[model samples]
Target chain A: VGPGDDAAVLSTGADEQLVVTTDVLIEGTHFPSGSRSDLIGYRAIAVNLSDIAAMGAEPRFLTVALTLDQIDDEWVKGFAKGIAFCASKYGVKIVGGNIARGALSLAVTAIGVVPTGQCLLRSTARIDDDIYVTGTIGAASAAVKDGVKVPPLELNELWSRRVDDMSCRYFMPLPRVQMGVALRGLASAAIDISDGLMADLGHLTRSSGVGAEIELDRVPVWKSMDAEIAIEASDDYELLFTAPAKEAERIAEMAVRIGTDITCIGKVTAGESVAVNGEVGRIDSPKGYRHF
Target chain B: VGPGDDAAVLSTGADEQLVVTTDVLIEGTHFPSGSRSDLIGYRAIAVNLSDIAAMGAEPRFLTVALTLDQIDDEWVKGFAKGIAFCASKYGVKIVGGNIARGALSLAVTAIGVVPTGQCLLRSTARIDDDIYVTGTIGAASAAVKDGVKVPPLELNELWSRRVDDMSCRYFMPLPRVQMGVALRGLASAAIDISDGLMADLGHLTRSSGVGAEIELDRVPVWKSMDAEIAIEASDDYELLFTAPAKEAERIAEMAVRIGTDITCIGKVTAGESVAVNGEVGRIDSPKGYRHF
Candidate 1:
């Protein structure tokens, strides 16, 4: 479904619950100047899909509201193609959307579905639950750092390869949809790492009426990045969840089956705030990119 | 049902098909400079609900992606209250959404549900069907005209009342959801008049692979406005639909029962373009506010 219709009709099979989410990406704020149109489109949909994935559901439909500063045919074509590719990649359909004139921005809304009563929620995490996160963090932050202009520095093959890897991660975030779906019936609570683990974990703890203590040593970070900064870096788009401590081994096995690394990094506690290594303190304002 | 979770999960009762649509309202594009945030927020949701109404469905959930130039607590509170009021008015749940920093914009995605296989489509109008429009046109355009700076003009009670009515229509568009739902088994095809009569009718005719012949004198316009200009003025969020010629009386009765004015101004023809009277040609670029 493209523009021109009033609305799109989708068949939601009987006995299913619909999951809905939306995210915004602005050209001058979210991405740097001179960003590729294709990547911009892909990232818009990817972030919304990550939200759906964090719900432990399968994404089904996407509606994009795109505002372009000017009508560039090539840019529009590349953007459409990129959205179509991402939709196909994750089995989601581009259902309906609106195109308008304004500052360059993309607001994507994704719809997903799961079996009735099976959706994961941040309010369900319980005290004593083990916290886990998928994949490494800080790569996107590292990439954004490199994107800024700087004087040339000495580079070895190892450093050059690392930069290339992080840049790729920055442009193409992989949503752990499969891992999220598998975590259903296992994870007590789940959230996606978009506003950094520290900030998002605070949200989870507040919602669940519990707290968490992270073992910084057990957390994974991008090469040469500090564990604290990695945990505070935004745009990771990885699943962060909690499960009963006894199910930690089973969750690890599920991750292996899905071909993603899962690390047990913390434990939920009885409180309403998140702590680092049993020390109670506020998670400071994000040093990583903040949407607001 | 809020921003803390990954996504909002909703129950879709058995055998219902989901209808979804999205619309964006950008500062300086959709509204005038220094517009009230409350009205902006209400209009954003109102437009999307109008799309759902055109599909002959009942709105159930909404996800909004709001990007602001800067964080203003009063503006945010007012915007939230406006959205809440409209959601309560229409029974739409505030499912999930994102708030980010950037150009002031609100992208609203609404999801509705209709009986299985009964949702209306633009491509279903039959040749020889009678085309009808709900409500009077040109009021919104007139209101926008009056909003701009103007020299002092005499304001008699009659003219003052008329101006107030038109401005009310401009600020608060009543989406004809109930009327659309009632027309489900009656109207052949339907579309909401967002881009005005001619452009939207062109969309309907093209989708149905048919043509339309409109009688200029039969169209209802705001006081003293030309029929052509009224038909081309945007933001008159009325419903334009086609029904069998034989059922015109019944449809008119239905409109009466629903407390709205319904006027038959045209008929579907066995061709592929919309004509004013017997003159067949393009509608040309809109004289109304064009999005792009």
Candidate 2:
């Protein structure tokens, strides 16, 4: 049974060994208990997996940290079900974890891998690399903002639906798994859009030691939201990536192969600071969810 | 330089694979902020790592979950120093982690391993196993109690030193790495004593589908605290384990090899329930640390 062993041995047919990351979601900060137990559990692991995905790594295993106040079999069962569902969907395994007591929170550490030296990163972006993002953005923030303000009863079903962006992306944000895998050899640098595009791209530029000229006209926003609203709201969880200008067409082809949307937003420059249109803007020094 | 890559690259030789475990430590329950930051970091990783050591594993890489109200570089530095000291002490690598905003807490997910199928567990005890433990217990709890009470005697370093049990184990509870490795083939069932010995033994017996006879006379207590005070106090982080009755001498020799103290406290039987004498006594369940 391999019981009492130092480590749980997990074998992967792939060459590159493992990808690891951890994120702590607190009780009052990440979300209110308003989220279903199932989604909460799913998102707990999903967020960490997304970090792995952003590296273009295939998630194979996760170790979760859960702090609890009181133990309830049923509640634990629900949480486990959510975790199991995510694992099954991603072809990952729940190898091991610690269950301790405290204020309710989740700390998930996900590990995965790609070729030994072939993972994507923001540091690899060249000065002229084109910046692109995959799928819709800012829908989650809109969901949060609109979900709280219930619409009037006089509205029609369509109008009622319009009251909130129940795009299912906020409660259960999709990790760009296929897109990330496809970009393994295509994109030079990439990150998930946990914050706004401007903010995350700022991270990309800072890490890569380059600036970017992001034409607002070329930047993509959730078609449903007002352009200004989408620009400021974050929590998109989409893929914000940088690829060599020469490979932009190939990167687009990759997104097509993965059945994901791709939008060209900006191009890398030789200096520091992200410029919106032609002007050096605050986009270069992007600010995200500040929880001080 | 696999910066921002989809997956992080880690290299391990054949002799030493990766040992992995994740644990969540919360505030108010695990520690108060006034609790020494260095010790909090030390114990957060130490308690989680005790599981790995109990399995006879070497600690390698760690992914930390840092939740904070404000980003105090000093606190971060202290916490990092604590982790770095232990990681360096155990030859562990700190590769990557995420910093999130929330209540001050830590969830350290550590990875280390020994050979395949060599990890220890609580389900391996046999019918006639002689139970053994490494080191004095209840020191951590005593330390915790001492940490809260600020002694009123100024310029009394001797008295403060004499009274601070928390100063000993509370901040620096030892993980029984040597004893765990020594029990590879000698001990049958094993687990680190997170809960008190009696309570944790209850888990051991339950896991093995057996009962145990733990003589109150044989249970190990810290020199600084009386047996009565230590019984209910936990945070010992010692290895409470069982081996074949025939291997008692070998067990002692192995304990010597590990440079840790050992005591034969009890034996395993073919029934259910854990007890101090011969009956299932009230161990008080340690305020229920498992919550869902």
Write down the TM-score for model 1.
0.90
Worst 10 residues of 1 chain B by lDDT: B150-159
DockQ, model 2, C-alpha based:
0.44
Q: Would you give me the overall lDDT of model 2?
A: 0.70
lDDT, candidate 1, A98-209, per-residue tens = 7899999988889999999898998899999999998888988777888833223322222244334676666567888998899999999999988788878877888888
lDDT of each: 0.80, 0.70
- C-alpha DockQ of every model: 0.75, 0.44
- Candidate 2 lDDT, tens digit per residue, A23-96? 88887688665455666687777777788888888888887767877887877877887787777878988887
Error of model 2, residue B237, in angstroms? 0.3
Please report how far candidate 1 places residue A30 from its true position, in Å. Answer: 1.5
Which ranges in model 1 have alpha carbons more than 4 Å from their true place?
A1-3, A148-164, A278-292, B148-164, B278-292
Query: In model 2, what lDDT does residue A3 have?
Result: 21
